[model samples]
Target: MKALALVAALLLGTAAAGRPPEIALTFDDLPSHGPLPPGETRLSVIDGLVAALKAAHVQHVWGFVNGRGLAREAGTAGVLEKWRAASFPLGNHGWNHSDLDKVGAPSFLDEIDFNTPILTGQMAGQDWHWFRFPYLHEGSDPAQRRAVRDGLATRGYRIAGVTMSFGDFMWNDAYARCAASGNDAAIRQLEQTYLTAATEAARASRHAAQGAMGRDIPYILLMHVGAFDARMLPRLLAQYRREGFRFVTLEQAARDPFYAADVDPRLGAAPTLEARLKDAGGKPLEIPSYSEMLGAICR
Candidate 1:
């Protein structure tokens, strides 16, 4: 019986050792995101997120910042300070979370430049050259895209590519609404939907990566620092762990060849999983939408 149990254990270990998926978690809209629920301050949300990350032993999870949040919301700057105090790195999101596709390339470049001083002050001479595009929209036209890319390169900024996300931002507003209404049942439903979206998204992303790249590339999971996100983060991290994902630093994940363009902004724009799959003639995975689910629940 002992020999049989040992063999089973060995087999399970071998299966688990077979190239577990790697992911780097990144949060956008630092300092502030989504509508706050009753009794929960921005500082409280940051505290929750920081505690969860530290408890999970996830290090160097980058938080992309929009500098305007500091001036727009009093005491929001402390959120960034809290993040830094946790020893996590900060990156540029934009000055006002402006979309490059809407604003011209020149204006978008100025926004990036505008964000530099805050990043410099927060990073304190540390490397904070990574930039995550607002709304994940690079540009609407080829010329615009090229100009922004060139400007980012000149600024010594590397683009942060997002390969896995389930539109987590959508849930934040709904969660806030549900919480405000004191609807425990509705909030519970939101929790389930949020995790379900995340789980399905992870699966879809992995399938897409395999179909497009012929293997799993190190993934960058995009998230927001919303109140509900802070609430669900510990469970979310546990879910990823159960799915056999090994957390890695953004820099380490970017070292993969698939992220070469992202690691060096001088290269062409980093190809998204959707783009790669489209180019490979593979069918795109259907991302689950919670819009209707969220719409009816809180309202």
Candidate 2:
């Protein structure tokens, strides 16, 4: 089966066959994300993830926390402590994962401000000054986007940008459902769907970079700290390795030219580099959305 999988990957011609690509892994919804299976504890989820990171030698992965999520999830502070204990850097994902579009600029900025103290308390002496916009929505308009950008600057925060994501969170939720139902066939299907999606997203982003900048810039992949991720991270990382991805810290990935885009408060927020590229007239990339992917399985 392993040999068959490899053959399938090669035939698809999407495997990383040459120079290794560089990518940084960043997880949002930290402390906890979604309900765990019947018996899984938050500690086990966090510890398992940290262990995977250690085994992968990923020294600088980033995890963003929603202050409210930390408060809502029982014993999440302990889970966050584990991240700090493992030396991972934490950033603010807002007090709640509020969308800037619906919350309005003023409310959204408040959310950003609201998360600081909790995050600061959790991450002493470590640089916890980065902010990832919840839902990757900066604002609905240029003015609103600039408003948040200015607010972040005033608070001494750099926006953590995501360039590649396979919607792992979507796969995770589906996996949890299948696991609960004891559907092994669905579980197997989910794994294959996930790996295939990851490969395709990587390839599309690489091309998007090429079309936009004439080269492949270091990518920052968005994932979540959830039960399925803990179980699958090793395999996911292995697939990335097979495709020639060298894991780098968020700091290192930021050094890539693509991340150097000046945060122009005058411009509206375009979260992913691909979006920015498309806005600048690059070819449209047909990346799948989580809702779109989930519909295929759920239906």
Candidate 3:
């Protein structure tokens, strides 16, 4: 998909149905530092992100580690330490950021296994049960989903699911350009674009509530701990807070029954945490892709 189109698609998917103090922030690629310090690139995004969370007094964050980078990157260890000390949750993103669905269950699970030790070693006391599927895309298959889950279970990892995400990666990038342009119009345009998406997403959930599900549960806001988020987070959080929404972690939100019970019979993804309720021969309708079955959002 084209970049703008792709960005819009991401915004719509996570916004499908929700409202309120329910939100979770997650970063993909830990230590998203650039080449290294003294080098201009120097994981600027990560540094910004960490500072934003610290200032916000955020207690729990899901850091998706890039195993290889952990060993090579200079500041990666330091970043991990700060997170560990603060007791934020750490998740495995794979030995590298390999796409789980594309890799097939075998290699996919292996990447996860290889990465776990490094993540555990860095994280120490906390549990590394959750995982964020790279690209937020996993192959749409039931068996593969099961394999991924079993692999995690074997190594004490759980598949993490996100219910809400802002295309913050894109949002931040766009804003960054506007700032550089030094144009007043660009700044207004940037804010207008994102604010509209955020509002629409919340509205979508509320509309779904009056029509279908009585209420939308906690919304998991996915963001990368890169150049964009660190700067965007404080503003995003403040914006949401004013909008009357609070923050949450993936663990807290996934624990909700509706989100857990969403089973796509085709690609099981992972078994629903609400297994008992899921049993007794009634599964929610296997709807088509949220993108396909439904028409283009933000079109």
Task: Please give me the total number of clashing residue pairs in predicted model 3.
Answer: 10
C-alpha local distance difference test of each model: 0.87, 0.77, 0.59
Write the number of the candidate with greater lDDT, choosing between 2 and 3: 2
Name every residue pair that clashes in candidate 2: 16-243
Using lDDT as the yardstick, the better of models 1 and 2 is 1
Scored by TM-score, the top model is 1
Write one digit per residue (lDDT tens) for candidate 3, span 133-194: 78777667867767766665566555567655535455554545445545557556555555
The Cα error of candidate 1 at residue 166, in Å, is 0.7
Q: Which candidate's lDDT is highest?
A: 1
lDDT of 3: 0.59
**Runs with alpha carbons beyond 4 Å of true place in candidate 2:** 1-19, 262-272, 275-299
In candidate 1, how many Å is residue 247 off?
0.4
TM-score, candidate 3, is 0.70
Candidate 3, pairs of clashing residues: 17-205, 18-205, 21-246, 33-43, 34-42, 34-43, 45-226, 45-227, 101-139, 129-158
lDDT of 1 by residue, 129-223 (tens): 99999998887798999898888888899999999998989889998889989999998888877877777777778778888998888889999
Write model 2 residue lDDT over 144-200, tens digit each, in one string.
777788877777777788888878888767766777778888778777777777877
User: Residue 211 deviation, candidate 3, in Å?
Assistant: 4.4
Q: Candidates' TM-scores?
A: 0.93, 0.88, 0.70
Stronger candidate by TM-score (2 vs 3): 2
